[model samples]
Target: MGTRLQNKVAIITGSTSGIGRGCAELFAEEGAHVIVNDDGSRKGLGEEVVEHIKASGGSASFFRADVFQSEDLRKLIEYATETYGRLDILMNNAYKGHATSVLEQEEADWDMVFNSSVKAAFLGCKYALPAMIKAGAGSIINTASIHGLLGGLRHSAYASAKAAIVNLTRQMAVDYGKYGIRVNSICPGRIVTEGKIEFLKKYPEEVRRQQAVYPLRRPGTMREAASAALFLASEDASFVTGHALVVDGGLTAQLPDSVAEPLEEGLGLFRTE
Candidate 1:
């Protein structure tokens, strides 16, 4: 069979690296023309991924813009329509600096997080929805986190923003479903990427404890999460919309009784794939 995304035009925000980068690469590999948006920093991950896609015989281009700004978002959307003539997939996958608990989070910090995470998604949908509506069908995939589905310590702003994204997904589905646009959110669990791996290295005990508690007894990979995103944005999930697909390696599924036994032994459910 040919690529699942052949001839499709996609816009993936914050795709300089990490999960967003993976999505951009995968989409381009499957034959979609991708617009990689980032802050245009010379050292940004977006440029790197664009290079990766181009080197792999895929078609992609980069746009430097801050996702938090409405103008920037509008520009990106307009660029897609003007250049590619249609926008098929819109993936909101950008995040910025955040810190500990709500008490420690400043007003500026909170604004920064919300603008980057929640506001960005809102603007992406706001601008891209019309194109989808006109085209008669499209996919909008918001990158949420397991924290959005449940509580976690020292992640108030990120959690709140992500929770908003999940709700926004539902609301968009309700409002735009009639227009043939499918909206959904993906809640990714603990996945070991370069940043996370380095962060975890600073806390060996916590990493070990997390590994033990996960049913898979390990963290996930960026590519695995990207694959799930692909499925949501593809015709394979044509009938699926307004859903929060949690890819947490069973971490969120571990209940009190389920974890009591494992916790007692300093291990988790330890299931295999």
Candidate 2:
């Protein structure tokens, strides 16, 4: 019912749940015909999302594809253009990675992470850009992460892939701007998804530890992350491009809690009770 993306056509990969689904639902709610995609890892879930959208009176459908494959990405683009006659928004949100250091990481894992995160974005643009160029305008949102900016302790592969995406987004914007295409990435910090809920439940200590670093004292919700995507996808960000808008709940804006906590205790910082 929002007009920000009224009548626009969008495709979001990895949309069975989490940030992908969040964007899919919100984009539909804003009147964009959304293509909710999954890697077939969650077939029923993808259909459930489409049904949810229709029930809510938003336009959406499901598309299953493995974004890591160039061919699959091409087909996805074709589906969007054939179904809707144009592609207005492309959000590459499908990702897979693990907490493994260089010493502990396997070559296959590294490649998988890169293929899922970086190559998929590349392929999405490769196929979607032509459709967008034909129309002379489009918005592409790549999901980077705070780990991409600050790097991660154990998230080496995922972080590296995200960093590549951040730069790739810039490169795409530089090359595609002449065609009126805007490319941008959002670097989210700790977002509260179902995975995080389970994580916190199992490792309860992380709850307080997570709350300490962020000025907001909490993790971000999917809706909040989706809102950031919405801004970059909609014409609201018409003048924005090649930007990595950090949505980290102020995590990157401050010192690490490990270092700052003791300093806080001594300096009476945040001591007000």
Report the lDDT tens digits of candidate 1 across residue range 130-231: 899999999999999999989899998989989999999999999999988999999999877767878877877656677677787777899999999999
Candidate 2 residue-wise lDDT, 23-136, digit = tens = 888999999999999888764898999999999999998888888778888999999999999999999999986658999999999999998989999988899998899899
Candidate 2, residue 14: the lDDT equals 92
Top TM-score model: 2
List the global CA lDDT of all models: 0.87, 0.89
